[model samples]
Target: MTTDPAARSAPRSSARRRNLLLVSVLALVPWSVQTFTAGSATLLFPWGLVGPATGSVTTITDFFLRFTMGLPDYILVWPVGVACYLVALGSALSGVLFGREDVRLTAAGLLLAGVTQLEVARGFSVQPGRTAWPVGTVLLWAVAGFLYWSRAGERDAR
Candidate 1:
């Protein structure tokens, strides 16, 4: 009976590759969510106050007028939003092509979650200002990163 070195090493190599892929996938979730949420707010929401832009047009308008007043003449963040969308689209395409589908999904998830949080915060505040929104954005990103790290470790073990 004999065992080849090449054969033994091959399994380890494959295992390592699989481990890397798993980690990438897991890491992608939070990033995607944050990216998606941000992108959505800029692209979808009329006011471009990223993260959970859930509110009536009036509410959204008020948010923009109150907080983002006189910053720029631009009414909407559509241009920046378009650029972000392209980046997200590219990230997704690259992830899929490189066998890292998780990255794409993660980005989307991050964006959505972040934007949703923003929306929620604004909706609740009687007179929303710039003060509270940044906090929400930071918290969402932190949670997303934490979740990604935790999930990556769990997935690799399997």
Candidate 2:
């Protein structure tokens, strides 16, 4: 039996959407980690901050504080985790939007991911979680780069 035109195109379109979703999830991973990390700093949550602050399990904040790394002291003055989370959130949205016919959005996503990685690294340097950020950043960068490359390939194929 011959495949209908819609059937043929549907798989491709669905594949693209799935890929975009996967990329979005990857971008969200760091944000989720950062958010939980930030939430444990205090029982009271910041009004401007996103993510749940109650009953946090693991956070860079707690880690640094427990380890006496002197990094938590610096972080005490700034919402470093919140900033990272926002950056990651932005990147995730950009990844999803990049699947659309917008080149600018994809660039924005790449920039967001890069900036977020930098911010996370800075937090790590200042605190005790330097090791974690590198792993997460590398994963994020690899995924982001792959998604960008695939999109470029699709464009070139057209």
Candidate 3:
């Protein structure tokens, strides 16, 4: 009985690419939610879990205003959000193109998670919804960590 190395490795490569794509999408969720909810009360209900079916326009607007005002203008800048989105997108692209995972992806994920934590801590007093960002950021970090750890294990096994 014999086995071909390429045949054995092909499935693993495909699985890795799929995992990276999934992680990239997961990482984008927070940014998408934040971007959509900005200046729009209708989007707030799902993202921030605020407002109700019968909620008045004033009520929704008030919540949106409060949430927006809670964060610093610098943090809310469109460029900053776009940059973060790009980083996540790049990480996914790198994972797909480069079979060998790099430490930078894990570092970037951890850095984003840390920043989100700081934002939550500083802004939670003003906007409770800010806490949700950490959930997505942490999930991104977890996936990156898992990928990094699994790769290391594979090297050891080899």
Q: Considering every candidate listed, which one attains the maximal lDDT? A: 3
Score candidate 2 by TM-score against the native. 0.47
lDDT of 2 by residue, 36-137 (tens): 343343221211223344544444455545754555443442344344434544554544555343433443454455545555445645544322234445
Off by over 4 Å in 3: 1-5, 31-74, 77-82, 98-103, 110-114, 127-133
Backbone clashes in model 3, listed as residue pairs: none
Could you tell me every candidate's TM-score relative to the true structure? 0.29, 0.47, 0.53
The local lDDT score (0 to 100) that residue 146 gets in candidate 3 is 69
The lDDT ranking, best first, is 3, 2, 1
User: Of the pair 2 and 3, which is ahead by TM-score?
Assistant: 3
Off by over 4 Å in 1: 1-104, 107-133
lDDT tens digits by residue: candidate 1, 11-79: 545544543443344322322122232243321232333344554233344555676755433224323
Extract clashing residue pairs from model 2.
37-59
- The model with the greater lDDT, 2 or 3, is 3
lDDT of 3 at 76: 45
TM-score of 3: 0.53
Off by over 4 Å in 2: 1-8, 31-104, 128-132
* lDDT score of residue 22 within candidate 3: 59
